[model samples]
Each structure stands twice: as structure tokens, then as C-alpha cells.
Target chain A: MTALAPPRLPTILPLGLARGALELRRFFRSRETVVFTFALPTVLLVLLGSVFGDHAEAQGVTSSQVLAAGMIAAGIMSTTFVSLGTDIAGDRDDGTLKRLRGTPMPAAAYFIGKVVLVAVTTVAQIVVMLTVAVAMFDLSLPDTAGDWLTFAWVFALGVVGCSLLGIAISSLARTARSASAVTQLPYLALQFISGVFVNPITALPTGLVVTASFFPVKWMAQGFRSVFLPDSMAAYEPAGTWELDRVALVLGAWCVIGLVLCLTTFRWRRGQDG
Target chain B: MTDAAISVRGLRKRYRGSRRPAVDGVDLDVARGEVVALLGPNGAGKTTTVEILEGHRDRDDGEVAVLGTDPADGGRTWRARIGVVTQSATDLLELTPAEAVRHFARYYPDPRDPDEVLELVGLADAPRAVVKLSGGQRRRLDVALGIVGRPELLFLDEPTTGFDPQARRDFWRLVRALAAEGTTILLTTHYLEEAEVLADRLTVITDGVVVAEGSPATLAGRQSRPALVGWLEDGRPRTEATATPSALVAALGQHFGGEVPGLSVRRPSLEDVYLELLSAAAPEPALATAGGAR
Candidate 1:
């Protein structure tokens, strides 16, 4: 009998891009995902801004400005961490991941597709948040190029860091329902402790502050706060500073650790413990 | 390239925290271009063995080769030449049959045309969303994706479970078509009729070990079993199992002094022989002491 020749390896980039496009299309098609990712944060921002009013002696700025800046970070976490974590778990439970594993598709290509989806959604969420904040609440963003540069890096790092963590944490969820429920815990807890809901970060207990510092959410909120808030508002934060360098360092570290954890623990099958 | 499309020996696997090994010291081989069915009841190690062959599960101890390559070491190039239809339903609710087929086609080096594959699988006019398709249509979509790559060897794990009669027949026809195209198929099924119709040979397993292996007609010395001869005598039914039903019928004809009344000869069905083989090889309680027993 003659052995059949193996097929040539297909270019991974095109395949990855195709997968990303498919994911984006599916994301947009789902009205629930679109509303949760794009609309909910802006609505929450407006509600909080209206209830708390703009002028606050704590930061010498409107509460809307503080919440809006922090809400962008919260939105990134929701899109990348909460949404992705649940989606991956659902895919695993439904055997989609296993079907993909059976094919010649590379695992990295699948992950690249997920990253692309997160990036696209992140940009859209940021746009909506900023547009609503500026148009409705008179929120002022960064006026200098350097501040914009900081915004870009923080945004990029925040998404990447949270997405990797999402992938890693998804392995712990054996079912789609559990994934949705479990992700909500971190998403809500981070919102409260990371100052997404509160104005003065220093007002929180030291233990809670230290615990929040160990995660990327607080750093991401601080990074965005630095970009959107004026230098005088740094007094509201711990250490009486924005700690921009620490934001970069902490988020960068989480990105590295999250990547390692995901690479080691991600599974194509739902029941696989590893 | 080896003539054997699949070869396994001394295969063993024990699920974590399980008392008995799921697979134990099983051996199997399938010649190139042949359709072989692994037949067993549920939890009889058929899935475990097939998963090992598909490289989806790791075997604890075994020598296995599929298409001349060890599946444990099977890379993307190796994977491209084989297709697998797993037991569980694939959930691609967002994609239409055409879209899914087209997307999977890109993963192969030389995949069949997506439209042609869709037509072949009888999903030419599938619904716009897969979630809207019937169960049979969804299953056909799975088969479409499996064969779109034009794999040389295909592994089908209970492909017809939950299919309607017409759908099952259509799926059998599809399998036959693939086999006619020289694809070697290893299928696992509990349906005796399905195995008889689709497989060129059969491998019967019980309690993680192969108890019988041969063509459907000759498995477990089925051809050697006596045929049952029956007739109507004195307005009452009479039956007898005889080694030579033809000779018995001749004698019965003479006794009747003419054409026999309602005479018929019946051989043992494959299902009967399969059940006997399984019962004969059923594990005794003492066998639990075996090292790999659990």
C-alpha cells in the first residue's frame, strides 16, 4: 500500500484573521453581547455621574470625570475578562473547542483570533465611553500627546493582561453557567475595590487596597485615571501620586504571569483538569 | 507506508480513580482501504481505543500506529490526512452548513469544494443557521466537515446515534461512497445492522478486551453453528436445530410423503453470535484482582 503525502501547512495568519472576523461577526450579531460590552458601561457612567454630581472637593473635579475614566478600565475588564472567560467555557462545554482541536488548526491561531476579537471590542467600548462622557458630561480627556501615548499603552496592556487571565481562569469553569457566575465575582469585586465605583482610592481600607493592588484592575484604573485626570487629582490616590510607572510595571507583570498560566492550563476539553 | 491502516497491541488505559482499567491489553488491525467496525456495548472500551487512535487521549501502555505514524507523535501534517467524527454533537450554532464547510476547508491542504461536499452530504439547501437545522441535518453537516478534507483515513465514533431511519440510510450511503473512493474507515458502533452493512470486517470487544474479530459472516465461528429447521406438523409448529438442515428437510419430506408443510431453515443472526461471545467472555468477580482490572 502507498502512503498518502501529507498536506502542506496552511498559512496561519489568514486562518487566524478569518477566525477573528468570524468571532467579531458573531459578537456583533448577538444583541446581548453588544449591549453588555458597548452600552452598559456608558449607562452606568451616566447614572453614577448624575446621582453623584460633577463637582467634588475630594479630587477638585466632577465625580462624572472620575467615574468615566475608571469606567473605561472597567469596560476593558468586562469585555476581555468576563466576556471572554464565559465564552471560552461555553465553547468548551459545547464541544466547539474539541472540534477545533481535531483539525489541523493551530492553538495559537485560535488564541490570536480571540485576542483580535477582544481588541476590536475594546476599541469600540472605549469610543462609546469617551463619546458619551465628552458629549453629555463635559469630561475632559488628555490634551497632550504624551498623555495620549500613556493612554494607548495602558489600554493595550489592560486588554492583553485581562484577556490572558480570562483564558487561564476559564479552565477552572467546567460548565458555561459556572463560568458566567464565577467571572461575575471578580468583575464586581474589582469594580468596588479598584475605585471604579468610588472616587477617593485612598479612602478604602489598607488591606483592601493591598489586595486590589495585587491584581491588574486597580493598576488599569489608575493608569486611565492618570491619562484623563489632571495632576492635582493625584492627591486622591494612594501615595499622593498617580504612580504611572507602577501602573505600567504591575500590568506588564500580570500580562507575563497570565500568559504563562494560560499556556500551561488552557484545555481544549471541558473535563481535562490540566 | 505500511499496508495496515491501523495497528494496536497491548493497549491499556485506566481512568483516574476508576477501579478497573477502561481498556486492557487489546489488539486490533485494519488493512488499507478496508472498513472495520469496532462493536461493543456502552463503556466497553470502544471509545477509549478509538480516542487513542485519534490521538485525542493518551494510552498508558501500547504500541499503536495509524497510517504509519504513531498518533502520540502525530503533528499537523499527520493530522491533516485523518478525519474524526466524535460521538458528541459539534455546536456551531452561528454558522450555516455552507459557511462551516468553507471555513474547515481552509484548514486542509487540499480540501474538496465546500459546495460539492455540502451537496454530497445532502445539505445543499441547509438552513441559514445551523441551530435551525434538524438533528439529521446537523449530523450530515458533521460528516461534511469530516470528509471535506478528503482524508485518507477517517474515524467515525457512533456517527448514526439518534438519526432517523432515512437519515441513517443516507449516512450509510455517504460512508459507502467514501469507502468506494478508497478511504480507510474505522467506525465504532453498537448497531449490529449498521456494522453488518457498512464494515468489511468486525472487531467485538467486551470489558476492555477483544473477544472476537472477523468478517460479519464468520465471527465467533458463526458459519459452523447449526441451522434451525422448522415445519408445521399435525397443525402444530415444530422446530429442530440440526447440523445439516438440508438432510433433515429431505427426511422430513419423505415422512410427509410429499412437499414438507411450512418448512424453513434459519441460521443464527450476527447479533445472537455477538451476545454469546460477550457472555462467554464476561468478567468474573475474581478477575477484579488483576493488576489492570481497575
Candidate 2:
């Protein structure tokens, strides 16, 4: 008798896209995820923007504008870091990851799907926060094509950096309950030191500013500020300039570090000690 | 393809920091299109062995081949040929059954129609939402996903653990239908009745070792054991274990000249032999043997 033919393997791109679309649908359907990812940032933007409306703090810009710019970076952190971290940890706890491991779908495809989800949600969060800033708080839109260019790269790099960090940190949470608690501590700390809450970036302690500069959050906030604020406003920045080159360098380094950490440390299943 | 869908020799696995291996020198062979049940109590290493074959868990030592490929190095092509129904239920709470099945179907090159697979698994008209499904219906959905790829081999780990009697029977029919379609099935279950009804061969494991292996009727020499001749005589119960139960019944018929009251010619069941095998394999064999004698 003739031998049977081998089974055909699926290509990664289409399968990963389908998986990503399914995860997006799930994200939108869940009320808790929607509330946390979208509503919380918008609410923070409005609340903080209204409380500090049009009160020029430094470099002739209102407090709301600085916070609005800073909130964009904070929003990316919320969606990519806090949201994705808990979701992955919960998937591990619920055996969803284990079920996927038994199938022919490549693990890289699974991660690609996760990255796609993060990219989509990051874009959505940025759009919502910026719309609210311009429409409700009188925050000016970026005028020059150069400003828009800065916004684009910063947004892309921030999403990639925070998403990789999220996947890497999610391995620390062994259960669904601990996942949120584990991620929230660093998320809150980053927001404070990155000057998302404070009026003037220089008002923060020198040591705290130095510490925040070591991470992506501070650079992301700085990138957004350069795009939203006028050129003269750069004098009030910690470096007394927009420092776009430094922003690129710091965020780029984080992207590489986060990717390496994820590849080396992520666990598909907990207690797989071997 | 090899004649055996699954073949293992001297399979061994020990969890880290544990004194004993989870699976110790176990051997198993399942022929194509045959249903084999690995019977054992909890912590008997049934799940460990099945996971090793599925390539989800690494085995410390042994030779294992599923569909002529070593599971340790099996790639996507080999994985596509086998399906696994894991013990824990998957949580796809947001997607409907149709959505979930169709999504997973894209991962396979050739798959059964999602609608038809749902029908085959007896969830044709069930609710759309996965979270809304009953426990049995949810399980049927799991089985649907497992077979949607039209796998040549299926591994089910306690497929009907929480199923009610009627639901369990329906699941058995589904398994039988899959087997009829030439799917080699290896199921692990602690229920002896389920094993007897579903498996063509039974392999009993205790303390990570295979103590007995045979057809359900013959495992542990069950068929050769003496039948118990029980009856009521003058309002008192009497029982006699003898090899020639029919002959004793004939004599009783001759004496009574009619039916023997409360008479039951009971032979050893699969459960009895399974218990005996487990007891013999237990660490405290003397205590178990004494318990089995009564």
C-alpha cells in the first residue's frame, strides 16, 4: 500500500492575525477590560484637565496641557503594561495558554497575536486621550509636520517598549489574583515619577527625576510634551530642551531590554520548573 | 504509518524535588483504530503519561512514539495529526461555540466543517455563548474542538468526569462514533464501568507501574476466577465460591425440583479484578490482601 501524505502546516501571519482579532473581540466584550483600558484614562484626563484648567505653570503653558501630554504616555502604560500583564497571567491561571501549547500553532504566533492586540489598543487609547484633550480642555493640536513625526515614532516605540515589558513582568504573577496586584505597584510608581500628575516636570525631586529617566515612561512623556508644547516651552524641561535624541535613545534601549527579558523569562505554564 | 498509534517502552518521569518518579518503567502500546483505557486512581500518573505523549510535558527517560514520531521532537506537522482534550476545561468565555471552533479550525490545514463538528458532538442547537453552556454542553464543545481538525489520534484525559449518567452515555456514543471513523483513542479514566464499556483493552497502573494489562474481561485473570453461588435457604443467606457454578445450580435444581430462591450466579466483575490488582500493587500489600479476602 502507498504511504499516507503528510499534513499541511499553517502559515504564521494569517493564523496570528486571526488569533489577534479574536482577542480584540474578547477585550471589547469584557466590561471590566473596557472600563480599565479606555474609560479610566479618559476619566483621569478630564478630571485632571478640569482641575488644572488653563493655569499656566511653566514656559507659558497651562497645567492641563502638560498633564494632557503626560497622560498620553500614562495611557499607553496602562493599556500595554497593566492591562496586558493581568490578561496574560489570567490566561495562564485558566489553562488557556496550556491548551494553545498542545496545538500546532507556533508560540511565536501566539506572541505576535498578543503584540497586535497591544498595538491596536495603544492606538485606540492615544486617539481617545488626544481627542478629549483638544476638544474638552482647549489643548492645541500639533501644528507642524515635524511635530506629527515626533508623535508617530514616540507612540510606536512606547507601545513596543511597554508591551514587551508587560509580557516579561507577567511571568512573576503565579495566579490571576496576584497579577493585578503585582503590576499595579510599578504602574503607579512610574506615573508619579514620570510627572504625569505634577504640574512642572522640574518640580519633582532631582533624584526622582533621574530615576524616572532610566525608564521608558519619562521619555514617552517628554516626547509627547515636545509635540504638544511650543518651542520656547522646551526651556522648562529637565534637560532645558525637548531632547528628542535622548528620548529616542532611552526608549530604544528599553525596547531591546524588554524584548530580551520576555524571550528569556516568559513562562507558558506555572510551576514548570524544568 | 506504524501499526501502533502509540508505543512506549520503559517510560519514566520524575518531578523535581520528589523522592519517587511519577511514572516508573511503564510500557504501553495502542494499535491503530483501537480504544485503550489507562485505568488508575488519583495520583496514579495517568495524566503525567498522557501529557508526555502529547508533548506538553517532558519525560525524563523513555522511548515514546506517537504516529511513528517521537513526541519529544515532534513538529507542527506531527502535532496536527494528534488532538488533545486536557483535563481542565478551557475558558473561552467571550466567544460563541461557533466562533471558537471556526477560529481553531484555521490553525489546521484540513478541518471538518465547524457546524458539522458541533452537530457530531451533540451540541448542534446549544446556546451560542460559551459561558452560558451547561457543564455537559461545555464538555461537548471541548470534544468538538479536539476532533474538528480530524486528527488521526485523540487523547482524552477523563473526558466525562462531571457528566451525568445520560450525558456520559451520549459522550460514549460520540467516542464510539469517532473510533468507528478510524480515530485511535487513548482515554484515561478512574471509573471502571466506563473503562469496561468503552475500551477494547485495559492497562491498570498503580504507584507509576503497570500491574496488569489485558481486555476488560481478562485483566488480572478476572475471567478465570470462580463465580459466587449465592442463595436463600430457610430464611438464611448462603454463599459458596466454586469454579463449577453451573454444576452446583444443576444440583440445587434437582433437589428443589424448581427454581432456587434468591439464587444469583455472580461472576467476578471488572471492578473486582481492578481492586484486586490495585491492592496487590499497594505499598502495604498485606493489609490490602487481608481487606480483599473479606
Candidate 3:
């Protein structure tokens, strides 16, 4: 082989939250992607709340409040996992990722942008759902600042976990159409099992509760339950325990697992074997 | 050292479960400031070779060096040095042209000004909303992003596939300007006219191997091939093939004793040479017929 010329070194761009913000701005501008990201969760929250109006009072809880928290979690999952996954797959399908691979941008920067986009949208969606729930279902705000902090950390971790999982799944989808279908399946299943529609604590089997605990969905829902459900309601649990600390640890574990999977499996372009 | 910008030797790639290699025993050296076009029909492994060079895919065997590093092992630092325009639209739909360019500009160590790149690609006015732009405009944006980094080398994979005549000409001008500025470019196109107009040298690949390599005028000795001398004979069009068109014209000059009306000499075109080469290597005569028809 002949002597090859040296690569023209690129100036490393600053990678931080501010750059993440810039990427979020770009993501929000796409009406279709945004609608898919936030719309389904919002609509589900409203529709479920209206149908279950006053029924929750009989159970000594508010339907809107439960639905609101669930929708917040669901919205984060959709934006970070499903939407991002499908978008990445679409980019690879169209050779967009292939083009970017030749650029100076570090691969980490790309994921950081995605993380920021997902985080921003999660916050927005949570706020909107909470505001709507407060006005329509007489929902109460968190009792203390610690509760609010717990909510924020759990939401953030959940977003990270979902985003990485989405990236991992994107490696499996060869085309955009198939990615859409594959990504949506998990969210639908998780919603029902983790009390997005009904209280999984009462409606689900003990085996499922154990299985859900191993995943991030149960922990995320339990985090929300800590904020909204009364302390006395702990009696309904199989262990009669409020596992906020355990929820945090589980979600953190999920984030780590997701990161490892994404790092190992993600491809900028579709490989022939895949 | 001749300042070789890209170097490859015994490069080989094979898709999984496939017996045939996508790129087989290919060796190439592109010097700094040289414009080398890779010409090949569909599925001729041009894309696989380019992808390996771009560092987007892993090579199964052999040594391949792009800009002094093996692309398969080059990390993010190596990636920042070159530009790539794939045969596809931009992934970003929401980003405006200005925003997209500026965003990508951040990645390069010595990037060109975003505004200048857009202007050079003739997309200065249409800087906002990539989704709103026309196909030609979008392609220009792709080019703008590719050059925003002020790369030493650029890879253009069928850059003008969807361009109109005017847009294609404009792109050619931009390519010429980039080459004049000492940027080594590798372009792959099915358009022989594009190679004729832009490339200083070209390599035609067939069946994962180079069939010919030279200046367009010299490849297959197209310039020296038999020319078709056509003219009006007794109110009817007639043509004759001869290795020496001047000699044939002189003979006709005596027969007519004056200017031969509607007389012209046409050499074998780049397409003709390309087709002949494809025909000889075609899997079947029927396939060759459809290939040339396309």
C-alpha cells in the first residue's frame, strides 16, 4: 500500500447541556415527529381520565392523577424510545447516518443530542399532563420538595434507560416502516402491565408483579405512585412496603443495562448480516 | 511521497453468507488535489469499496488506508477529517439549512463558515426548513453539509443522481472549484458525461475488479477508436466506420470535390466504451441487452 495522507483533524465541539438544547430545538420543529412523540400520551391521558371520571372517587383515589403520571411516563417512553428508535432506523435506511459517520461529530455527541431531546420533551409532557389533571380531576401536587426531587430523578433516569433501549432496538430494524411497528409493541405491552390503564397492584397476578419489578416500567410507576398515592395505601402491597429507594436503584440499573446494550449493538449503517 | 490522499491494497469485502466478494483485491492511490471518479454499473461493488474507504463499513480482508489511517480502525478523530455525500437525502427534516450546517460545522476542527458553504452550494436563500426544499435544493444542502467541515478529501456517491440539467451543471462547477482549492475528491456516478466533464482520471470496475483506469479520453483508447463518418449521399443519409477519419474525409473530399454536405465524424462515446465493457462481462446476453437499454 502507498503511504496514505494524514486526516485533516477537526476541532472538537463543546459537548454539554447547551449543545443538547440546540439539538432539542431542531427535533421539536418537525411537526410529525413531535406529534407522534407527545400526542398519543396526551390523548390517552385525557380520554382515560374523562371515561373514568368520578369512578376513582369510589376507590378513594383520583383517576386523572394516576392516568396523568402514567401518561407522563408513557410520553417519555414514546419520545425517547419509539420515536428516536424509528428516526434512527429511518436515517440509516436513507443513508443519512452513513453520511454523518464521515463527519467530525463524535458518536457520543449524537446520543447526547438524543438524550437532551428526550429529556426536554419528557418534562414538557409531564407538565402538560399534570396541569390538565389538576384542572379536570382535582389532582393534588406533591406534598414535599423531596417528593418533587424523587419525581425528577426517576423521570430523568427513565428517559435515559428508554433512550438507550431505543437505540439498541434501532439496530434491529432494517427499515423505517418495520421500526415503527417493532418499537410500538413494547410500549403497548408495558402500559397495561404497569398500570397505565388500571391499577396493576390489584388487577395483575403476583408473578407479573415480580416480573415487572425486574423491568423499569414498574419502578417508574411506583415512583409516581409514591408521589400521588396516599401513604396508607401501602397496605395494599404484597409486602406492604413503599419501595422508593428500590425503585430508584432498579431504574438506575436499567439505565446501565440499556447503555451497555446500545453501545454494543448500535450501528450507524445497516450491516449486511443484520 | 506524492502526497497520496487515499491508499488501498488487496482490499477485500464479502457479505455474510455470500460466496462472492463485494470488493476483491482492489488497489488504489489517490493523490492530494486529484479528482478520481469510480465508474461502475449497479452492484459492481463501487458502493462497497467507497463505504470501506469512508470508514462506514468493516472490511473483511486486506489493507485499506484513507488519509493515512485504516478506516476500519479509525476512531472519531479520524472521521472528522473527511466529507461524505451519500446517495440519499439528509436525515434531518426539522433542521433549517442554516441550523443544520451550523450544527454540523461544530463537529469539524477547521470547518468553513456555514454561510459560505450554503452560498457555495447555491442554497443561501433556502436556508430554512429542509423539508420544504425541492429535491435539487435538498441535494445541494447535503453537499453543503459535506463541505462545511472544509475536509481535505470528499466522497461524492452519485451526487447528481436526481439533479436537473441546470443543477447538475452548477454542481459540476462547485466540484471543479473544490478540486481547484486542493481538495481531493472521489466521485461515483453512472453518468459518463459527468466523468468526462469533471474527473481528471477514472477507474471503471466490473465484477469487483478494475476493467480500465485512465483519463476519460484515453480509457479504452476511446479518442483513437474508429470514428463513424456520416454524410448525405444522393439525398439519403449514409455512414462508414474507419480508424482514420481524416483519411476517409480526404477520400470523400475528392469524390465530392468540395464541402461534403451534412458531413460529420463521431468518435465512440464514453457510454459506448462502457457498454462494450459491460457486454463482454455480462452474466447473460439478455441481461446485457437490458443493461444497455437502461
Candidate 4:
């Protein structure tokens, strides 16, 4: 043979799409994961909104509307952070990661697939949360082009930041069985400290709010609240105004922090593997 | 430079906090297109050795090469040339066999048709979720995924662990076909019959070191070991172990004046050789001598 062609390596985009599609197919195929796991936040939103919807917070803003907006932010975290931390741990435990490692597929392709999975599922999750909020809790849809733009960026950044943090935290779990517990405690505590559940953001201690401000959840909840609630309701915030610039800065910073964490902490195979 | 598809020299690995090395010192080579079977008892470093060669794990001390490149530095192009069937079965729980095969097929530059692969593995009609498949079917699916890439070199670590008798037969047939097509295969199995049928050569490892390596017929000198000669002598039984069984049988028959009543000659079966090798190697990991391992 005179000259043979060089070996062709598999590209990332197509393989990533394939992996993403497979992940979605597997995720939706299991009715339990679809119903109990993904749908848990929506159910919680319904129960919380019903009890709090009657209490009015600010001008034309019922506590339920505020709660609905906050819950949407929490719902994104559920689909991204908690869900991925647990599911990726399961992937590690079940030999999925090792199987893929043996193939020519790049690790970045796996992350792309996860990002796709989170994006589609979260959009679906947000739609359900929004519909329930508008129909039952009287939460108004954003009427302005500016407000809708805010919604888009907030959703994108929240997804990216939380998903990377989720992937990072997954390695901290010793096993898949422990992942849910490990992620859930921080998830629930973040909800409280980030002002997702507590009303009038000022209800939480000032020092606690300052500490929660460093994380993305507080900024995410605060950002979503600005997009959904009336402008006059901004006065009720701890800062007395919707600090959209600060929200962007903090979430953007966490996105970088999350990426760094993932690079340092992600484990493809368990340490015990030999 | 050599003909080996896989080559390892004096490999060793010790997991942290363990008193003994997981893989003490092993040397192995599987030539291009050769189907080499590795046999060992549980926790005998078979998996650790295979994993090191597969580039799934690192060996603390070794010069390892798979397909002309050290597995530690194996890149995507290098990985494209090989396939691995792990010791543990990995199920894509919600995906059908067809879907899983198709998904994994995209990872190679050139992959077999997913449908053809499914049919080849006897999973053509596996319409149910992977979780619902029987143990044998799951193993077949693992083989299907491992082979869909049409790799030049394939490593199977305990590939038939859960297969039934017929499934094992079918798998042996597949291995034969693969070997016939010039695929280099390194197989680890407990079934001696399967190894005898599939492997061109056999390598037995124990206590993280190679105890024996040769063709299935001659491994551990199975072919040359003394044969047992038995006959009935005046209503009593007599037997002798000798290198010249035919000559001894002939003499016995002549001594009986016509025919040797109930005469039987037996050579060491592959199983017998394997058991003896394992027992001999089990004690004293230090007795595993290394000389021309290079």
C-alpha cells in the first residue's frame, strides 16, 4: 500500500447529540423518574402557593405570585443541580461512565448531553410551573419585551451555573444511594437561605441573606421575582430595588466558580476502581 | 516492532491500603489476530490486568502497549481501534437493545449496522427495556455493544459470566467468527471448555502473576503429562501412570493372553491440567518465576 488515510476520530457534536437523545429517551421512559422525581417541585409549588396565595405582600402582589416565581427558580435547580448530582452518581455507579470512557467519545460530549437534557426538561418544567402559577395562583406573565428578555438570560445562566455545580458535587457522593441525601440537604437549606420560601426577603436575618447572596440561588430567585412581580414590589426587597446588575454579576461569577469546581472535582470513575 | 497486538512487561499494581499487590508482576502478549484466553480464580488479578491493558486503569509499574502505543497515552484514534466488554454488565435501563446499540454505534468512525449487530447477538427482537432482559440476553447485549465498533482488537473480561450453556455456545461461535475475520481478541473466562474451543492460546494467572501460558492443548504441559493405564487382572483392578501408554496397554493385553478385560487409557484433560496449575500456583506467590518475560 502506497499511502493509507489517517484514522478518523469521532467528533463531539454528533456524538453529543446522540448521547443527549439517549439520555432523554431513558429519562422519560421511566415513569417513576418522570412522575415522582421531576414532578416533585411542581407538587410542592402547588401546596405552598395554595396556603400563601391569600396573603397579599405588596401592591397587587399576593404572596402566592411571589412564591410561584420563586418556585420556578427552585424548579430549575431541581432539574439541574439536585437531579444531575443524583443521576450522574447513578451513572458512575452503574458503569455507564466507564463504558463511555472505553469508547472514543470525549468527556465533553457527555457534558453536552447533560446540558441538553437539563435544558429541555427544565423548559418543560418551567412551562408547567408557569401555567399553574398563572391559572391558579394569579401570577401574571411578563407583558414587556424587556421582562421576557430578563427571563431568558436568567433561565440560561441558572441552568448553566447549577448544572456545573451539580456535576462537581456529584463526586462528593460515595455512592448513588447517598447522592440524594447529600444534594437534598444543601438544596433544601439553599431554598430557605436564598429567600425562595420565606416571604418579604427581609424576614430572613440580614447576615444570612448576605451569606446566601454569594451563591447563585438567591440571585436566581431575586432575578425571577423581578421579572414576574410588579415594579413597585421591588421596594419590599432587602435592597429596596431589583439589583439586576448585581444578579447578573453574581450568577456570572458563580458560573465560572462552578466550572472550576467541576474541572477540579469531577470523577469519571470511582477512586476505588482498580 | 513485534507482532503483538497487546504487550505488557513485568506489570505490577498495588492499591493503596492493601497489604498485597493486586497485580504483582505479570507479562502477557496477544499477537495480531490471535484469540488468547486468560483463566484465573476469583480475585486472581485477571480483571486488574485486563483493565490496565484496556487503559481503564493505570498500572503502577509496567511498560504496557496496545496496538503499538502505551495504553496510558492512548488517544481517540488509538481507542477507535479497540473495544472492551467489561467484567460488570452495564445496562442502559430505559433503552431497548436496538436503541442502545445504535447509540453506542455512533462513537466509532465506522460501525456495523445496529440491526445486524442485534441479530448477530441474538437480540434482534429485544423490544423490552434492557432492565427486563434475562441474564444471558444482557450478556449478549454487552457483546453486541462491544463489537458494534468493529474494532481490530477486542478485550473481553469475563464476557460470559451470566450466559447459559446455549448462550455460551453461541458466544463461542461468535468468538470463532471474530477470530476468523482476523480480529485480535483477549478473553478472560472461567470456562475451560469455552477457552479450549475459542482460544488459539491460553494464559493462566494466579496471585497477580502468570502461572502458565501456552496453547490450550499443551498449557502447563497437559499434553506430555503421564497418562493413566488401567485393566482388570484376575477380577481385581490394576493401573499405572506412564509416559508410554500405548506400549504399556499393548504389553498388558499380551500378558492377559488375548485381551485386557475392561482396559481404559486416560490422559489429563484440560480441566485436570488447569486445576493442578491453579493449586500449584496458589501457594507462594513468590514461586512464580520470571526470567524471559520480556
Winning model by lDDT: 2
Best model per DockQ: 2
TM-scores of all models?
Answer: 0.93, 0.94, 0.90, 0.93
Docking class of 4: medium
**Candidate with maximal TM-score:** 2
Q: Which regions of candidate 3 are displaced past 4 Å?
A: A1-13, A16-19, A56-60, A271-274, B232-238, B253-262, B281-294
**Chain B, per-candidate TM-score:** 0.91, 0.93, 0.91, 0.89
**Candidates, DockQ:** 0.57, 0.65, 0.52, 0.63
The list of candidate 2 runs beyond 4 A from truth reads A1-7, A272-274, B232-238, B250-261, B285-294
Interface RMSD of each: 2.0, 1.6, 3.3, 1.5
lDDT per residue for candidate 3 within A1-274, as digits (tens), equals: 1134553444333553535777677676667767766678888888888987766533577666666666667777877888778878887887666766777666666676667777777777777778787888777888899888988888889988988889899988878779999899887888777766776365687777766667787678777767776766555454577677788898899899998998799887664422
Cα lDDT tens digits for candidate 2, B202-264: 999888999999999899888899998998899899999899999999998888789999999
Q: Worst lDDT window (10 residues) for model 3 chain B?
A: B285-294
For model 4, residues A1-274, the per-residue Cα lDDT tens digits are 1133553666799878888998899889888888876678889899998888678886868999999888888999999999999999999988999888888889989989998898888999999999989999888899999999999999899999999999999999988889999999989988999888898778999998988888888889989999999999888788899899999998899899999999999988875673
Report lDDT (Cα) of residue B45, candidate 2. 90
True contacts kept of each: 0.57, 0.74, 0.71, 0.72
